[model samples]
Target chain A: MSSKITWPVPDPAAPPEAHPALVSAALSAARAYGEARAEHTRGELAESSRTGADGTATMRVDELVEGAIADTARRHRVNLLSEEVGFVDNASALTMVVDPVDGSNNAASGVPLSCFAGVMVEDGVPTEALTCWLDTGRCWHAIVGEDTAYRTSGRTELDGAALGLLRPHPEIGRSWWHLAERAERVRVLGTTCLEAALVAEGSFDAFVDPGNDAHRIVDLAAALVMVPAAGGVVRDVFDRPLEIDTDLTRRWSGVVAATPELAERIIETVRG
Target chain B: MSSKITWPVPDPAAPPEAHPALVSAALSAARAYGEARAEHTRGELAESSRTGADGTATMRVDELVEGAIADTARRHRVNLLSEEVGFVDNASALTMVVDPVDGSNNAASGVPLSCFAGVMVEDGVPTEALTCWLDTGRCWHAIVGEDTAYRTSGRTELDGAALGLLRPHPEIGRSWWHLAERAERVRVLGTTCLEAALVAEGSFDAFVDPGNDAHRIVDLAAALVMVPAAGGVVRDVFDRPLEIDTDLTRRWSGVVAATPELAERIIETVRG
Candidate 1:
């Protein structure tokens, strides 16, 4: 596939809003990239031979998407913070945090549950966020100073709550098991951004990353804007604010819940 | 929404095999029904006012899909066995096991992870199966006497395997926790048929339903054909054959794994 793919450019007739235009560019780039590579067989896409800047093995499709997203970000004149390439300074105050493809394994294996996420941060605060499902072209967005379109389910209790968890590894196994015991349902869908979007839209009561710092800044930036806009709370496991530097090296464990009450209950239970 | 929605009929020029045509009819009906109800607001679809034949609260979308499926099965001359509206004998030797909407809660809440599943059984043995993802019109099918289109990942060990589980409830909590401890990853995506299909297509290594007889015949019938065709194994927790009566009153706890070795290990670990 050609590195330069054609996508719908932002309309000049629209109002001159930097954040919305940045989000539109990201969405168009992701959709175009996904369509270009969707025809590859699973075996072809699952080949992982290179190490990404995030310290994980990168698949062929991941690199392709990262390149596409980087081109789009540069065209939009936004600084880039991404998983594969880390932080790329464009000498601009507006930084677009991007996970070119979250749940790369799912995408390579044709699971249809992965997504692309971009959050435009201005002056160390996320002002706009957009996440698009790679398989379906469905997009969700939230802006800081606008009316929220989606809200949480307002389910405050742990019992009978629908929840999503990051996959369990040794470091976080016990914590994941504890949370699983308390949650009415636990889904580890393998995509952090999409799971967070599900919580923001009330489809899931909460999404928790147990104890391991498994998530990076690129993964949580979109959720940080979306959950708050949806009347939900996103916080670390210790109940601290989920703040992080715009770098891939740092990791955090946190919960995105439909309500503050539910977030608190999750913290207490998981800590125990 | 009108009950008489128009869907694309199967082409008459296609082969007239009973099983393939039956699957085609089911796919067309499900797509049509999903499109008809896709425009409803989440709140509207989430309204559950009546009890279903399975003793759960029924959503409006479930009723709509079930009616459409029933109509299709009648036109195809296959006897119906479904979760909602129970068994409707059409006096035919072939039985179509249908879960009109497998992940009803996800569908109602706009989660985009739900699916429609149907299995054609002859003399208590599943001969053909079809699963259609409602959100995306992707479909997977298998025939007993034909070449299978999908295959498993061939991961024989559990250490780094991608696993899926049914949500933990009181009756099955201990088994679920045990399995969670042993597996590398666990996802409770809330749709049994789709998860099984994921395993069949090499996305997940295995899928387990711990206990409490959480699944009905309508859910596993499709997986029965698909998993085996994909060179995977599906068996009960006690290592018995996964055969069951064609009625909805009975339930089973089972494991669908990419390999026989993994399936056996899961049974031993969860049973302990």
Candidate 2:
């Protein structure tokens, strides 16, 4: 109500030993988004102020949060690859790929479902990831080579499965409905990184894009490292590699599932 | 996740002067659900423990949370009407109708989108309502006739509107698709009360069930009071009165919209 979010945004609970770039970016993103809400109305926040390098209209809320994160990346001396601002090259092997405010619409609309997701990539290989829910500072961090604090649901079948999915589009609505029909429970949470985190934490059997080609590299950066570490699979429906390409316009339909079997099943189902 | 939600369920931020019965029930529900997550694996928590009074399979997490709320109702000397336990007659004029854990599947599965929603009704009239998000303990409380701290989005047109909705079912899939096609944004969060609370707080333009009669009194108890107080209208698709019916089996397709025009448009769209 009143064109503003009344509740205060909480500080992110980034764990100890998280990459300094990720931690700083998450904190800066949260604080900037919070201040954006306090100062701007919903209309202002949701306004498409400029075209992002990703070939999409960037919302003011996304800009504010991304601006803060870009500053953090510069301070940390890491190359930044983000949704709104594209890549800020520092010519370093270490890169921070992030969705500064995932679920930008939810963030501007005060839906309390937005997140800050970032991954540490070393020489085109993802090393670690962190995802923080902005409304409440719940963090899920995982290193690619190390054990995770979480686990997947270990589900292998589409039947009796619980899934988080993207909303349907006219072109891809069938894919959405098909997976939803097979699953016993379905949720469209409007935040990809958070949904992937839920799958990593064994909350849902999978988080899928359903052939929508809705995810950019920044969108899946965290899931690319985190899900596999948590005993799950991160895949593209068309079997494309999730490479760290600087082309922000490239898209993928990401499927983050609890098990390799389940991920394969989802891919086959989408293909059908 | 090891079958446990590692994050602590926060204490509810219920406003001062909230009804004692509602406050107690919310606190108890959050605590019990948190404890259930700690003790049970996702499978154990999600097991269809029993048939609820609402003619549906109840999860163990729901039972645990409802059990706690039922005890709180008895201590508060109020009649209790909950989904799992049905109605408990305390022979009092005041009745606390509650969905102890609104999103049972999400709660049990650790999706962190469930809530505790309760409405205090006096002689068939809902006097006040409270919705507490279990994972974050954020509360939205509103008195039927009093001014509220929040406001609705005040949107009228379905086109360019944002909505929170129930997931599509085969029987009502067309209706779900129809409104989704018109809306600018769509989310299926799997929790009616929390979606309705978002509608009340201006985070979303509407929360709809399409033509699926998925809501019992307890599912919509809080929205019936809170949404209207925040300048919105709550209606059933079939135009049935949201009366204080003792029959837990009775269902309605709830349409909680930010404005009467938007509510009417949604009903027409579903009907078409």
Candidate 3:
């Protein structure tokens, strides 16, 4: 069963500056939550079979991570919107959207692509975001209009430009053909959250997930904060502006997030 | 243009323990070659998009990796059978099969799903093997019938159980759908060599690649030795034994590497 979350829309008159100290505290909390869950994920993956229908072990890891985040949110006295456990703490100065494990399925099989995502919302707008790639020990963080950075062993901001693209559903089969025709060296990584984080670092130009309705909010919430903070845009398939307050629990079918120019070019390529 | 490699037929009468240290030296040489190439794979991936229609950059990385392995084989005074460069030092005491970087495409995409594979042959029979997942810093190794152990950040041993399935290609549609119907969670990490190593570790039930024809002896060579050494079975989809000596440069149409029983089962699943 699914449920809707209600949020108090921030007033336009509310001050836009969210506390940087609070953002720092949130980042630390997110990192701790991610570290604790990493051990559980490793053990679960080790004991689990790849082909079994019972993904209980995987779910248990997700639940534990979610619980840890929720506990931390309560301790921090922050409202939380989490993928595993929905919204909590209705009225608070800050709101956190958490995805305990973004690539749950991949983590279950010991695939090295899973991550933990967190985004902070202030006054009904995303203010800060962070993500940690579990296996790689890579972390990315962004504060809107302030700074965006990626860190593994040390801190640095990505400078190279890589484009992200979304192929329309109608173009799925023919898309590769078109890619071949355009001589585009494209890669489909299959994890939406990871792609979005890449967009924030300016390492990737765009991210296109045609059906937003299919993926859970845990994947997109952090991306929502990161992309715009890095000067990228996220929109619907028909190229309509996205509303942050929309019910995020459901999939957003046909979404594209990219640099303005690249997004337009990708849409044009698909249309052609 | 494509070429074929010739390998010596295994001589059952030859001493099994012959030239163990030579195999070790060859393995070490292979590792050095792989490590060198891995250092540059990231840069290659960063530059893949800028490559022209002729795929000069892709070919360049392949040639560079292949060249290093050939040089290493020369230095070690061992015969070499490699994926990109084919055969060298044909009549030496130790014949090393090497894949400098498996998952070339993934390595070219910053996917971290690539590895180096090496197998040592004596009298045409694989005697020892080493496979290293470059990104994770995990290595799986086996020397003849001695216990096979996997070395990662944490150490683990294959229980002689579990199947590791590779990519199961559908005759049609997305090659991924084959995994959807299974009771087990399907994992596609995008690197053929790494998947093969997982089979060697007994961490997975089987590895199946139905439609892709990129499985070369050099790619599977190292994993094949480790898997069989760990008491697992490895074979092609036709239930035929994977012949490591056959034209090493050519790729197989489909492969199923697992316990003998699991391999048969997966083949049936593909056929059904």
Candidate 4:
């Protein structure tokens, strides 16, 4: 399907305030891209006849989403690091690490927890992030200093905090162990991007996904911008500062999330 | 907060048609009742905090919800069976089992996965059921004669035919072994009642809650109506038909649900 969004040329002179807008635009573009990916995945699922042999394989949705992200970045002349196809368009100081679709496997299986996520960073500092649920048409955004947040229906606050976790892969034993110990009431909603957004809404105390499935940078780009802006925290599993750079592109399992206390505790639990 | 909803009234003498009005009324009433339960839960959590406990116990929500259900049912003159308290108004032909707050621990601990559920059974057969989410204000309903069904944000589908299951608890190796053997995608969303509603929506294949925590007849009532209406199936681990009776109260050891074939397979696998 055609999209109405036009890519604006990145002007180095442009004020940083436009960063969130850029992130939002990229997310909207990614939603269409994700839908196309879903359609392709639907066909693939039908052809595969329910054998999950392809579970670990790279998805067609990935390619479609990456293409969308790359096109948007190239038009805006911003650097991009996308999960599906990797890095591209490195002319501007501002960069975006995109997950064309988080929870691609769930999307392929017709689970409703899949989405498109894009995070923008300026000079290595996260400035904005956007996540869009492809099927539900719901979008969430976090922009530094702008104080903007959104939520879908059914959102609630308990103990004055909302925290969500994506599927805690078996590898994140520390995370689960910590949760079991704390038993502070949590949710594993199965979507990383959405979990991060939920953190932004203060609907959750934190959102933690420590699996090394992707580089910390990809998850961080979104978490860094959203968590802090929402008056929460984000950090690595070690409770150390998370810095963005080329090293993050490769897979490294670590905690990525909201609330420093939650992060530190998770790191300690996992380390033990 | 006081509510205007009249409860415990006689069933519509003319046999209420499946019109949107009846559904709306049921939903609104359920919502009001659910809120009362939630408020009580909040108080319980606070009490737990004062006692230096982490507030994971579901006892408070259970009592509050049961009370609300009774008051509401009394207004409607409907029969009721609740998880916390036992049967009330049992002489009525159409007995209503009300799981005042499904996923009580989750609700008590600030997790948004819990919900309020009820089912209307005539002569031991479910004729109608309603589920209301206290946090999100979303409601679902199912009526007899058409199999079970419900609504979610304008989406409608059958239960169990599209099943969802909680990952088997390690303690219960049999259930997971069974699910893996059948290649069923087992999930643990941590809320049995919500899982049951998804069965009505066909969003999941079935739902399994091995830790029967709040396994009261009232807890399964609404889901029972919806699942059957949607052409899905649910059963205890032994492959016995799921019944709404006092036996299920707080039994949390294991449970299984799915389409007839899948449910049967899961039962056999666990039985072995």
Error of 4 at B204 (Å): 3.3
Best by DockQ: 2
lDDT of each: 0.74, 0.91, 0.51, 0.52
- TM-score for the B chain of model 2: 0.98
Tell me, by TM-score, which candidate is best. Answer: 2
Give TM-scores for every candidate, taking all chains together and pairing residue i with residue i: 0.85, 0.98, 0.68, 0.69
What is the per-residue lDDT of model 3 for residues B1-272, given as tens digits with 9 covering 90 to 100? 01111111111111234344333433443444344344543344334333322223334445555566676677767887776556676558778877766766544444455666677887788887766665445556677778754321121212232223343322333432343344244444556677766655433555666645546667667766676675565566554456767465455534434446555555565555
- Candidate 2 vs candidate 3: the lDDT winner is 2
Model 2, residue B113: what's the lDDT? 90
- Residues B1-272, model 2: lDDT tens digits: 34677777877888879999899899998889878888888778888857999999988889989999999999999999989888899989999999999988888888899999999999888999999999999999999889898989999999989999888899999989999999999999999999999999899999999988999989888998999899999999999988878899999999999999999999999999
- Model 2, span A1-272: residue lDDT tens: 44888789988999989988889999999899989999999889989967998999999999999999988988899999988778899878999999999999899899899999999989988899999999999999999889898899899999889999998888888888899899999998899999999999899899999898999998898998889998999999999988888899999999999999999999999999
lDDT of candidate 4 over B1-272, digit per residue (tens): 11111112111111244433233334444454455444443334323311101123336555554565566666666676655556677456766766666766555444445676767766777777777655444556667766432322121222212234454344554454344335424345667777776655544556665433335455566666677666665566643455655454334323434356666555555565
Give the CAPRI rating of model 3. Answer: incorrect
lDDT of candidate 2 at residue B236, scale 0 to 100: 97
- Candidate 2 docks at the CAPRI level of medium
Q: lDDT tens digits, residues A1-272, model 4? A: 11111112111122234465355545545565545543453435223222111123456655555566677787778888765455565678878867766766555544455666777877777776776665444556677777653322122222233345544444555555345445344555666676666555544556655543443456556766766676556665544456665543344444443455555655565566
Error of 4 at B129 (Å): 3.1
Rank by lDDT, descending? 2, 1, 4, 3
| lDDT, candidate 3, at A200 | 56
